[model samples]
Each structure stands twice: as C-alpha cells, then as structure tokens.
Target: MRLAFIGLFFLCTTIYAKQPAVTPHGVETPGVQTLPYVIDGNVKVFHLIAEPVEKVIYNGKINLLEEFVKKNNRYSGPTMKLPVEIQKIDGWGYNGNIPGPTIIVNQGDFVRFHVSNHLPEPTTVHWHGMIVPNDQDGTGGTADPVIMPGKTAVYEFQIVNEPGTYMYHSGFNDTKQALKGLDGFLLVLPKDGVDLASSDFAIMLQDWAIPEGSEQIKYLSMDRNWFTYNGLAAPNFPVLVVDEGERVRIRFGNLGLMSHPIHLHGYSFKITGTEGGPIQESAQWPAATVVIAPGETRDIEFIANNPGLWRLHCHVLHHILNDTSYFAQHQKNGIFPEGGLWTYLYVKPAKDQMTRASE
Candidate 1:
C-alpha cells in the first residue's frame, strides 16, 4: 500500500509538471491600437467612426540625416534641425486612427459593428475576405446602403469561415477614401480558443502620395512617397519583443497601391496562413520574405531561436526610406538611411538562461 501511494504521487507530480505554461491568447499590433468591444447577450458589439484625422507618420525626433553626417564628417550637406515634424497628413480613418484599430474575434462568433460617418462624404465598411450576406456586404451600390455623413449604419454578421487574417475598408469611393487611410485589420481566431503562438502580431502596410513640404495626402496620385506599417514609418515603430525559443506569428495586411516583399533577418519562417484561411501543413513552405499585394494578407510563423535584435522590413528599397528627395540629396555612395516600413524583433534569452543569470 505504501509503494502504491508513492507511485500515485509520482504520477500526479509528473503530470502536473508536464503541463504547459498558460500564455494569454490575443493579437498585438505594434505602433497601432485595438478596438474595444462590449458583449451583448451572444454578440460582440464594436463602434467605429469614419472621420478626417491628422496623422503623424514620423515624430521627427530621430534625425537619421544628422546621425549620418556626424558619423561621416567627410560628407558635406545640410543637416535638418532636430525636433522637426517629419510627415503629418490630413487623412480619413476609423476611430480616429489611420489604418484604424484592429478588431479581433473568434470563428463562429456573432459580431455587430456600429459604424458612424463623420467625414465630409458618405462611406461604408466592407469586410474584406469575409463571407457574409449580400445586403450586409457594404458594397454601397445596389446592395448595402451607404452611411452618409453624420449618420450611422449597423452591420451584424456571424463568422462562418475558418480562422484567418482579414481586413475592413471603405466601400464607397474606396480608392479615394481607403487611400486617405480608411482601413484596418480584422483577425479571426479559432473557435476552440487555443492560440499556439507565444507572440502574435498584426501589421498593416500602407503608402501615401504626399509631396514634400505638404501635409495633405494626394489620394488620386499613384506615385507614393511615404510608406508605413501600422500608420508609423520606421525608427518610430515599436519593437516586437519575445523570448528566445518561443513561437512567433506575424500577420501582414496590405491595402496600399503596390506590393511589399516583407523580409525578416536572422531567421526563416513558414507561410502558415493568408486572408482566405490557414494553409495546410503539407502546403506550407519556408520563406524569408513574403510578398503582400494590395487587398491581401499573409501570415508567417517562426521559432525565435536566436537571441538578438533582428530587422523586419519591406524589401522594396524605395519603401524603406521617408522623404525620398531629402534622403536622396544626402545619400552616401547611393545608400540612403532607413526610415519606412521597418522595425526590429528583440528576442530575449531563454527562460532557463534568465533564471541562471539571476543566480
């Protein structure tokens, strides 16, 4: 009897020890924000307002040109004074933010959106890549009615599709309104409520055709000069921090005019999913860069085995810098300073190493 009791104790201890640590399941949009929702009965309710907002692409505190000049004294050029406002634009956004706030939900969940139009013109919210009723599609032509300025529209739908990355943008005058910044990410998690990744991030890519020395966004122009991730250009975007050996997932959405080949340094990842749905394991392939075209979303996952700061940026050379003409004039040997659609992934040491270091 004593032996049996000891054996049972050992089994229970082993079982409890093998249990994995509980990590919260949710998506994080660095440099952007998330929309809050309230639960009414079985439905989740979200409120959004489309309005004209002044967006700051760069805080202008980090003068890359000045740094370059200080590093290379041989180059003689005019250095921009510190604390100059880099790029600010008058654009349209939902809930007071360009690219708006991310809306996260689960498969099989019923959701309602109360979208109010505060802009000077009418608009509608179209759920990109979502399967919903015809009338609730927000097409704004013969289908859903447009939400006129100063009016509100209600859209309710049950998510019947698989878990994946999706987006929402303006339906009426889409090219003009969306280009001015009326778009956002819509992420749907699994219904089982099990998110395997230790860190899940959502990033939205956008570009603007703003001329130098101007704060207005030229929505009709196709020549984009400013590029951003989550409404922020590089050097201003927040770092994505995670522990070494942890699984990391990043969802990329592009509503811009051009495609961006987003690349990650120091590690290779698998294209696990897209805006449509998760790719089968057999269909998944290893890639260091993934091209996200307009109206598309790609989800990539990797294990953070290396403990270091890794660069994650758009490979399009022109898209990596802000104020093209300004940087072009100060270019050294044809190399420009980094600025747009760029950020770092900071991987900390493993938990065991941290514990040992403390001792």
Candidate 2:
C-alpha cells in the first residue's frame, strides 16, 4: 500500500510538470514552446545583404523647397521646388508643383535629399513607405532633427526595398503641413528595366479650397472645395499625349482626404505595381477604374489601342466640381464639362505620331 501511493504521487507530479504555465497574455511551455511570443532559438536566421552605400552611385539627389507662396495675388498656396527647375506647378507643391517631383531611381541606387524650409514653421521630410535607417528617417523629434525656417537638412538612404511606388511628405506637424500640400512621390525602377516604355507617366490627385476668389488655400477648413490633378482643375488639367497602339503606364497616387476611383474611359488597364512592389504577372488583374486611397500609390499599364480623346476623371460625382461653382441643375443630367479633376488622353493615330516624330 505504501509503494502504490508513492508511485501514484510520482505519476501525478510528472503529468503536472508537463503541463504549460498560463500567463495572462501567453503560455510558457517547455523546449521550443517555452514562450509563445518569443522566437525559436533553433529557427534559421537570414540576413539581407545589401550593396555598400559608399561604393554605389548616389544618382538621385533632390533639393526640397518647402515654402508658402501667394499665387494669383489673393490665393495662398504651399510649394516645394526641386533644384528650382526640372518641373514647377502653381498649386501647393514641393519644387513648385502639386504632387512634388517624382524621385525616380534604379533599384539598389542611393538617394540623397537636401531639404530646405522656407515656411513660417519648422518641418521634416518623411520617406512614406521605404525602410530607411532610424537615424535617416525624418520623424523630427524621434528620428532626424527638424528643418527650421530658412534652414536646410539632408536625408540619405539606399533603395534596398523592392522596386515600387512610394511617397514622401512633411513629417513635422503632419496634420497641418501635409494637409497644406507638402508631399510627393518616390518611384523605384527595377534594375532589369522590364516593361520599360516611353509613355510612362506620373499623376497625383489633390483637393483644395479657397474662399471664392481667395488666392490662398483655406488652411483651417476640412471642406476642400477645389480639386485638381497635379495642381490644376479640369479645363486646365494637362493632357496626356500618347500614340495609338503604344503601351502606356500611368502611375497614380493620392494624398487627399478621400479615395479616388479613377476611371479610364475605353480601356481596361492592369495594375502592375503599387507601393508594396510589382505584382507578379500571373497575379495581375484588369479593371476599368482603379481606386487610389489616401497615402497610397498604384501603377497601371495598358496599350492605347483605341485612338480618341478619352476622359479620365474620378468617378465620384462630387469630385467633378470645384466648391460651389456648379449648380444642381447644371449637373442633374451629367457632370459639368468645365470643372473638377478631369483630364484627357490625346491618343494620336500611328501615322500622326510618326509625322510628329520627325519634327
């Protein structure tokens, strides 16, 4: 009887010892299951081998010109000018345009951004999607220091992530600064140069509002009554010129408060890539309208097989108007042709393109 009791006690104690300990949040088991949240010691570890920054060419260099400008005398707009040239837009933008300069770089290339702030307040540039080193990140207090008024700062990082569409914007006082139109894009082209075409383009959709004829944007108002593509509303929106039968790539990005379902008339395009990187060919699908949400970028490609002046605009009815400029009666039947974020794609005939090519 004494031996039987001793054996039974030992068996119960052994069984209890094998049971896992339950904590409020996790379970602590034995061996590989010691900690539910902890990484297994026996798991294989892999390191990402990147090119040395010093040995690679820092080919893409940009100078950010962040400032407040008075356009049309009464309208106030924020702008960013890169190198004071390359491209310039009147709408609130970096380097003097809305949707700032598209920083294009080959995969594995190094990039250097020299930011100069001419705004009334301090600011910093945050690489929106790329994995930059903590110190190079422009998060102001937590990462790099801010660029004070009339001061400059530099941010350097390598393109180690997969080739895709990313973005950059004011990180300091983001609520006010970014809302005031201080943002742009970063395009990483694959080194192999797959799907390279002459018709590649980039467009950024943004919203704005000023009191009727006021030249300055309503910085405090959430109701952005004005809409634009690269800073100009429709009737003034730039036309995308392409040739018939040519493969065209349009890179679309949105930094506004609303998502835009951009409808491309007469063509079903494939979303080839996004901020996350190029989607595999087998996984790509076709759509007539691609939706771009806030802080997101998408790349779509299609062959311009049909030749004509095709309308490209946001499908949302309200996105087709600028403030109270349009009357309910005027748009009761269809969208007013002279307002909103609409643009045209002038797909010329093959013969026309050839004739113009020689000139």
Candidate 3:
C-alpha cells in the first residue's frame, strides 16, 4: 500500500512537471493565450489572426453571369497510376469543381450566361429543358452560332418556368461535348420562397474512360474506368451531412451516356419534381431508389430520421466500382475495392451539428 501510494505521488509529480510554460507570442505574459501540453511532452500552440472574406451579394436581379471556358482538365485518384487529362473540359467548372456550380435564382429573374470557347473546336451552352427565346436556345448550328475559339458570347433569358430542378450542358457536339464532363444543375426557387428545410444539395453524376499511363480521356471507349459525383469518386467525395429529424432536398442530374439507378440506404423520399417543373403534391410518390437517365434530372426530398452513416450509390455494379480493369485485376486476386459512384450520407444528432460546423 505504501509503494502504491508513493508511485501515485510520483506520477502526479511527473504530470505536473511536464506542463508547458506557455507564453503569448505577440502579447504580454499569460495574455489569454496558452499551449496544450500532452503527457508525451508535446505542446500545441495556436495563433489568432483575422482574415478578410470575399462576399457576393445578390438582390433579385439577373445581373449575375459566369464564365465557362472549354479546355483540358487533369483528373487523378488513388486508384489511377497517373493523372489523365480530360479533353473538352471547362476552365471555371473543371478548375473550380466538377459539374460546375449550382445556379440558383427566383422564378421570374432574368439570368445571363457568359460563355467562352478555348478548346480546339467550337461549343455552346444549352439551357437544357429551359424555355428560352429561340435566339438564346444555344443549339450551336441551329438556334445560335457556336462560340468559336477565343470568342465569348452571352445568353440572357428570363425564368418563365415553375420552380424546380433544371440542367445545363454543352450542346455543340452532342455526345462528344456532353460526354467530356461538361454539365451542371440549376435550381429555381419560388418567388415568395421555399419552405425552410434542413438543407439542400445538388448532385451530378458522370462517367469517364482513360487508358493506363495516358493523359487524355478515351472518347470512343465504352469501358469507362471512373464514375464520379461532382467529379469526385467514393472516399474522396464530401459527406452529405444533415441533422436527425431534419428535412433534406437533393437535386440529381445525369448528363452521361448511360442511366444510373441511385439508391439511398436508410430512408425513403418523395419525388418532389424534375427539370420540367415541380411535381404536384398529389402526384408526388415515395421511393427508396430513382433512375436518372441521360440528360435527365430529379428532385427528391426526405426527412432524415436515421442517425448514422448511410450509403448512397448507383445500383449498377460497374458504376459502383472505379474501373473495369481495376476490378478485373482485383477479381483475379480476390480483392475488390470500395469506391466509385458512392458516398456517405451522415445524419448527426441535432441542428447544432450543422451550425457548429459552419461557424
């Protein structure tokens, strides 16, 4: 008993002795600053600095316009041997993020799009499913002229359709342009406003094929090696976070060659609408899975009642796996990896989880 007590005393002495003598780097002694000292004699100190934030303000006008440049973009992943260059890509969308940005506007606002062609060929931005004037239809050879290389043009149109999900993509070379990862989703809200939901998300799915050790995508190969949501495969994709008991609206769009049967593991949702318009409340239907075909878009809403990590992915087996060769290489050795058209839907306990994280 005495030895044990002596040992406890020594342990306490050692812990206290290891405490770091923290001092403020740019302030007076002990001025509201301290370092965290761990048992292994490690000290962690942090400095406080204020940084400026760039703010974008909107005021119900269609004055907002974005630039889209077509170029080659490099795509890489943990499964690939080297980064593959994707031809017919976007400078703003590919550089900033895949599938471009989420364009949100009121039902009656006038929106304009500034498009610039930088690729070897000509291209145009088609407001897919949008009822624009014939001149602003963006059909390249038909509705409008192609935005040639090093040339820029603008398409301005007023939103006349009902509030719902919509899609935008390259309409120049049809399959060739759209298949090169040139597509995005646009959201139109009711003029008054929408019901305050827990959160909202826009997910765009696409597929790509690139040969091993190659830089450019194989435009003709049907064996696509990479499937992505917003240009990121599983494990690399950001988690879709929401609070338990909160309602969520997920807008889905597919601009690839094939269709995708998207499945959500934990909850069923109502098909709220599509790119055409909002589905009437009486016409809405509940579904645990929905199929999005090429050039299609779907809007789904659900209450996150489950509090856990759930899987959201394409039901197609090959789409859920990264590459065909990778799958074959592993199948021969009995090793199948997880990642591809999959991501986690994280449901937290409370709304504070969202607020605390945003702050």
Among these predicted structures, which one has the highest TM-score?
Answer: 1
The residue pairs found clashing in candidate 1 are: none
lDDT of 2 at 248: 81
In candidate 3, which residue ranges exceed 4 Å CA deviation?
1-96, 351-359
Candidate 3 is scored at a TM of 0.71
Q: What TM-score should be assigned to candidate 2?
A: 0.69
- How does residue 112 of candidate 2 score in lDDT? 65
Q: Which scores higher on TM-score, 2 or 3?
A: 3
Winner on TM-score (1 vs 3): 1
Candidate models: Cα lDDT each: 0.85, 0.62, 0.63
Which ten residues in a row are the worst by lDDT in model 2? 49-58
Candidate 3 per-residue C-alpha lDDT over 1-359 given as tens digits, one digit per residue, 9 for 90 to 100: 99999999999999976864321121110001111112222221111111111111111122111111112321233433212222222222321334655556568776656666655677788888788999898898997898787677777778888987787777788676667655666667676664445477777888777555443456678888777776665545566767787777777888877788999988889988887888898999989999999778888888899876677899987887655565565454443444567776777767456442321
What is the per-residue lDDT of model 2 for residues 9-57, given as tens digits with 9 covering 90 to 100? 9999999777543212211110011101112343212111111111100
User: Distance from true position, residue 78, model 1, in Å?
Assistant: 11
Which rank order by TM-score, best down to worst?
1, 3, 2
Worst 10 residues of 3 by lDDT: 24-33
